[model samples]
Target chain A: MSGVRLLVGTRKGAFVLTSDGKRQDWMVEGPLFGGWEVFHVKASPADPKRIFASLSKGWFGQVIQRSDDGGKNWEPIGNEFAYGAGPGNHLWYDGSERPFEFTRIWQFHPSREDPDVVLAGAEDAAIFRSEDGGRNWDELTSLRASTGSGWQPGAGGLCLHTILSNPADPAQLRIAISAAGVFGSEDSGKNWKPMNRGLSSEYIPDPDAEIGHCVHRIANHPERPEVLFMQKHWDVMRSDDGGANWREISGNLPSDFGFAIGVHAHEPETVYVVPITSDSEHFPPEGRLRVYRSRTGGNEWEPLTSGLPQENCYVNVLRGAMSLDDLDPCGVYFGTTAGQVYASADDGDSWTEIVRDLPAVLSVEVQTLS
Target chain B: MIRVRLPEQLRTLAGVGKEVGVEVAGEITLRGVIDAIEASYPMLRGTIRDPATGRRRPFIRFFVAEQDYSNLGPDDPLPTALSGGREVLMVVGAIAGG
Candidate 1:
């Protein structure tokens, strides 16, 4: 295994953190994309040298970029995968009817089975697939016109933030939306079905209803593709049979409403989530910052507050801020709204503030580069 | 009339450190307020809106009370309740990925 590198994307720019295994020394290089909002960052699982980023320019539009040499160079793949309205098509923005511009690419994943296949979940609930290592793309029909008008943009652009591909079966994929619950695709995104069995959504008329809930992040164990975990807007859930069915796993967590979820690379039953105030308030619960760890398949959770701020911690971590490394001893890290990055070398047992006084962090990823 | 609250970065460009008050009468649109604000602060002309189309830039987001105003036209009249006293039109810099 090579040294683990952490990539931190923020409101202003992006930071690359290279650690020496020992937590004391770190090399940080960044401010990439120059203030563009980077929603997601990931290194190719098949080739760590390849990197991808999803950037949103607020009112302008969203873009995807690729770097083959570990962030040494970059290229944009926006126009290649963009959905456009043809001559007779009426679904477009403005009078040009230029098919809705991708507002953001909230999640990026490369297929474990096919190194050339890339998956992206974007704002407006769109899922894209690229077969040539992100050089080209095609809109996946699983999230396309078949879902009907009910798939209209949610309050935040009907965003799809998380995409999980089964390590065992490349044909199976799962996606999470902010206000649209969860959907699973069995035929590589050609067709889709709802998988919100035990989820909850207060935004809908029925508070306990499973279908219309808000999902912030979704993660899966690399070894056990049948098990999936997610951090919902108001709850945490697990699906034992991939995403065919789900059960609430937030009984022991501090607050159900959280932004991100991280599953241990090799441990199928271990995962991590950061609890924050739900809809009414967006701060840390009771004015304290804590990361909860679940070892028993989310049946129970324990708060890991060691090396964290004890009081007056008002910063909120967004959905993409937290991430885990695949190193033997996984490195867990998260950035805060107040422009800070914290890292834990021993899973979620203890922590250290790696950097301070940067821009609000939007997402973080760990890449092992020799 | 509708009042617009400038973000910190735009405020600095407008030569003010804090919020700037702009009055939008008639059909209060995002474009109308932006044009008025730019006219008052010439240095901010191309910062908020594009020079040719006058479309809102990618970094700036408009909000009427707590609602997002990005999808609405600049000439669209805001709800009367949102235009009432002390109801501010906020221009915020949206935060993207981590």
Candidate 2:
């Protein structure tokens, strides 16, 4: 049976929207974690029925949930995230040092080969890996130790929000920390290096420095990991040589400041970005919800906004809120801060609102099953 | 047997009633009781105190016979009423939501 499951993480809980290959009708099944903040939810590539979720409560702290039979039932695994004894500090917004504490698990990357292996990108800028399913987690000390004293927190706090592992070579992994920029590990998270060779950010003190570029999100065609697209704090950039270098691709977009960036499943060169007016005003440009698609990878773009709102659509989309499905027409899905999940089944040509009301969406993920 | 009362949310998570009795061996201190409770209800391991720190979570507290056990050392012996099943030692969320 061919089906699609949209794993959505929201401010209040997690949701699972399932549908057959048609991509028209959906059965929404959640607020699964109920009153907890589901930061990220993902199913392993090796086993679609195995799902992992990062949940947090204000008083109870982080809880890792796992499901064996899809998202139907879940059990708490572990929530103990310790950052070693010293508990180093990162640069604060006020240019002072503050003790680094685990705040949130911004992202999760499950191993392609092992359902038990899971990697979590956490706040205070570090990586934690769980080898025994989601039962326990230990920090990859080298990844955190490699980060020099120059690392600082962005407006969203020091968070390693993006974790991408090379499909062909599992040893090659890349992680992007807010304000701290991108880092790559070639030895299976044992050793890492700063991969911001040509990235430049004027937001920090050192504009042309190696690190401290507020990388909002990074996208690529899973088949071609060498070509990477990034939505930076104020620019849309692309790298052809595996992030060895980057050039501005913010071509004809209305605004370059946005969070979400995604690539079409079938088209390697095709990319999508929903631009906001500015960093402070995190809404669709001019109150119109428009999604810009760059067919040539960069330097050229076309607007896709037939079924989207063109008036009074002031919703903000987070970096991890947009994703793509491997349907024939290539479904594009994203959720907004206003609690709406919209899906475009015709490759961004038209759109449909899957769900209009839920908690404020924090993250969106899709797993294609056969 | 020690009667332990968990918060409403935790009660739901643990799938338990308002009161659950736990059996502890040897001297029934706060640490020993919590160890027994977590051993019985594995899901509540880190809900009260951090697993890494062995210290109480910031917004969680404990109360026994109306006496504050919030700051009591983990190794300290709790009031006999709490350990003897006469009164319930409550694990509560210190902050009010509404």
TM-score of chain B of each: 0.83, 0.91
Tens-digit per-residue lDDT, A1-370, candidate 1: 3677888888876788887766557878887776568877788888877888876555434456678898888765533445532221222222233334445677788876566778887765678888887766677754655442354344455677888776677788888877777888888877877777777666578755545577778888877878888888788898898777778888877698888899987777988998998766888898889999988989699989999997999988888888887766778899999988999888878999988888899888887556
Interface RMSD of each: 8.4, 1.3
Over the stretch A52-96, how does candidate 2's per-residue lDDT look in tens digits? 998887777778889989878889887778886333767787888
Deviation of model 2 at A143, angstroms: 1.2
Candidate 2, residue A51: lDDT: 93
Model 2 Cα displacement at B29 (Å)? 3.8
Per-candidate TM-scores read 0.74, 0.95
Maximum-lDDT candidate: 2
Model 2 DockQ reads 0.65
The second chain of candidate 1 has a TM-score of 0.83
Instruction: Name the runs in model 1 displaced over 4 angstroms.
Output: A84-101, A113-115, A152-155, A206-210, B1-98
TM-score of 1: 0.74
